[model samples]
Target: MIRSERNPAGDPSGPTHERVFRALRTRIMHGEIIPGQAMTIRGIALEFNVSMTPAREAVRRLTAEGALSMSKTGR
Candidate 1:
């Protein structure tokens, strides 16, 4: 679920955290990011050019929806 590449529309553009998160959620719901990949707050924040708090919030929501795993470490 890396966002270093262009979007599905094939357009190179600006920050896409919401877009990235949406895409990842779709893949994750479809089991693409997977349990093994283990998404992290900092990593996603870095990937999407956002702050950790926002990334944390997004991941927290996903965990709540059972999309991603909740780590006690909460990294």
Candidate 2:
């Protein structure tokens, strides 16, 4: 199961996209995801037990934040 630290704002229930974002951000920050490791929207969705939309949004947010990058083929 995917586990994450509690929200610092004391809000137990947050948006799915935000939760996914925070979880992914935490993983990135902690070096859990090795540099250049392969990742996919479907994989993230399955791992986080979320739909493709939330996983894509998390990836988009992370990419915008420079936490991840996409190639010409969107890898």
Candidate 3:
């Protein structure tokens, strides 16, 4: 039950990766996610009803953006 709504700039919420990234990024930016919290790919995938690929991508992007910190084991 994904929506196909597009923005004025023609950007649509059509990609699961982007959608997951946006959702996680938003939560991090809004301080919804506690600091030093551990997050797993499988957990995120299950929470968003998406695959591990998208969740992994979102996590990597967030880590790159400094929104999330990775541990030594890359959790």
Which numbered prediction scores highest in TM-score against the true structure? 2
Write the number of the candidate with greater lDDT, choosing between 1 and 2: 2
Candidate 1 Cα errors over 4 Å, as ranges: 1-20
Clashing pairs in 2: none
Worst 10 residues of 1 by lDDT: 2-11
Badly placed stretches (over 4 Å) of model 2 are: 1-11
Task: Write the candidate numbers in order of decreasing TM-score.
Answer: 2, 3, 1
lDDT of 3: 0.78
Q: Write the per-residue lDDT of candidate 3 for residues 1-75, one digit (tens) a residue.
A: 443312212446656778888999899788898898888889998998777887888898888888988888777
User: C-alpha displacement of 39 in model 2, angstroms?
Assistant: 0.1
Rank by lDDT (best first): 2, 3, 1
lDDT of each: 0.65, 0.82, 0.78
TM-score of 1: 0.62
Error (Å) of candidate 3 at residue 56 is 0.4
lDDT score, candidate 1, position 50:
65
lDDT of 3 at 52: 84
Comparing 1 and 2 by TM-score, which wins?
Answer: 2
lDDT of 2 by residue, 1-75 (tens): 444333323547676778889999999999999889889888888887777887889899999999999777666
**RMSD of every prediction:** 6.4, 5.8, 5.0
The estimated TM-scores of all candidates read: 0.62, 0.79, 0.78
